[model samples]
Target: MKKIVAMVILASVILTTAFAMTGCSDRVVLNVFNWGEYIDESLIDRFEDETGIKVNYKTYDTNETLLAKLEAGGVSYDVVFPSDYAISEMIKRDMLLPIDFGNIPNFIYIDGRFKNREYDPENKYSVPYFWGTIGILYNKNMVDDPVDSWSILWDEKYKGKILMKKDVRDAMGIALKLLGYSMNSTNDSELQEAKELLVSQKDLINGYYGDEIKDMIANGDAALGVTYSGDFMDLYWDESTDFSYIGYGVPREGTNLWFDAMVIPKVSKHKAEAEMFINFMLDPEIAFQNSNEVGYTSPNTEALRRIREESPEVFELPAYWPDDSIVELSEVYVDLGEYKTIYNQIWMEVRIE
Candidate 1:
């Protein structure tokens, strides 16, 4: 993937010089770092065609991976999609550029519910992209028992057929929830308990994956798997496959309500273009396309209205637009600071064991 991205960047550089030499001096390239399969690829072409800006896209599977790349300072990215807790961590470290809402008039289209939230109380650093919960996606035909709780992941009957997320937060969060604790629990004892549970259940895990969990679950490779609610929605409603029988459920014990938002890194050299890209994304039509392709809930009010008007059935799916009861039980992750180290250590111990 790194090699592929490097080739794209090289080609962009060559093309930029070519365009400039040919009198197209205003052309620009926007470097976007986001989660794998998080965006609608068609939108990139549209953005470039409309704005004369090329997109050099790259992907990371987890927030931790994104943080590591940023901290390493090996790459320069104009825009990044980090979750709520991640955005908070970057802000504290002065790693993000405060967005100028002036340059982004389309910010008004974002739902008020997502604004001034805990991660960016002043709403100066990031803008909500997609938001959803974490849940278990089980194959209805593969599992005979009810799948309402996090404990289902540990059922020995499904040993070697349970897929789990490679993400530390999601994995640990599941164990924390199973033990009746906050997904963001910083208590040492509580964290240790979660760690122990994960380590003990390692044998049952078929693999720890990211977006691939969707295909794995859909193809019957795993009887059950953990994934973002939005990803499950995509697989459940996928028209190319027989996924209509799949089932997804939030644990009765509650789960993480994650929000992946767009932010400009301090190292970004294309702040104006980055903000332009963000503003373009906020356009109702663009937002609608993205939400439709990614199967995530859009935080754009106008986009939601358009979706409701066009495809009321898709808009009404609980997996796409969850009810208040589920929303009430979900908690967004917060910056754990030093506690984050503890979580990483515990996560490492589980993986190694």
Candidate 2:
């Protein structure tokens, strides 16, 4: 199985452009780094056309891989989209360049309810993008019972039919939640218990994966897999897709909340253009287009409203694009500093042993 951790860096190599900027020489190029296939590609062309500023679009599959590239300073990126805990980690490491809200007037449209959080106090470092949960994705046709919670993945009935995420943060987060502990639990004993659970789950798991879960679950190779909310949306192929039977839910104990945000990196040379791209996304029409095409929720409130109204098909599926069920259950994972090593160590044990 492909270890899905080096996601961000690998996608960058495939999608990034090396050519010099053509539209604005004085205005630096804005490098927008994110997970592969996470955004609407048309937005890139639109940004370039509107502002005459070139965008260097790149992608990463895993937050850790993205952070490694940021730390190594391999390529200067003007903007990055990382989740809540990752944004906090980047701020702590000083790898991000602060944004100037003056350049992004669209900041006003973002719901204040989502702002003023611990990761970026005063909304200085990052702007929230798409947010969602990690949960079990099962083929209703393949599974004998309903999959409304994390416990189903551990059921002996589903052994060898389960696919799990390779990342320690999300994989461990699920185990922690199932065991009725915090996804961000700091107690070493609680963590150890989660680790043990993961170790047993690993044996029953078909493979530990991240990006591939979409295809794996969709094609019926796996009945149920641990997956991101948005990934299941992307996997929806047709009526035969079995979404009617498949289910996604946070356990009663809840799962970690993931908030992807737009930020200017310290390596950025195009703060102005970077902010321009962000503002463009907040436009309701663009936000609607982005979410509809990309299979993730739009951070723009107006965009979400417009999307549900304009495109009923996008809203009428088990994907539950508009449902806030998971949002209420999310405890946005925060940076645990050096304790990240603990999760990594335990995850390795679960994978190899």
293, model 2: CA deviation in Å? Answer: 1.9
Model 2 lDDT per residue over 133-184, tens place? 6777778788877566788888888889999888888888888888888878
Q: Which residue pairs in model 2 clash with each other?
A: 7-60, 7-61, 8-60, 8-61
lDDT of 1 by residue, 40-131 (tens): 99999999989889899999988899999999997889999999988999999999999999999999999887898778989999999999
Q: How much is the lDDT of residue 57 in candidate 1? A: 93
Instruction: Give the clash total for candidate 2.
Output: 4
Q: Ten-residue segment with the worst summed lDDT in candidate 2?
A: 16-25
Candidate 2: RMSD over Cα atoms?
Answer: 12.9
TM-score to true structure, per model:
0.78, 0.80
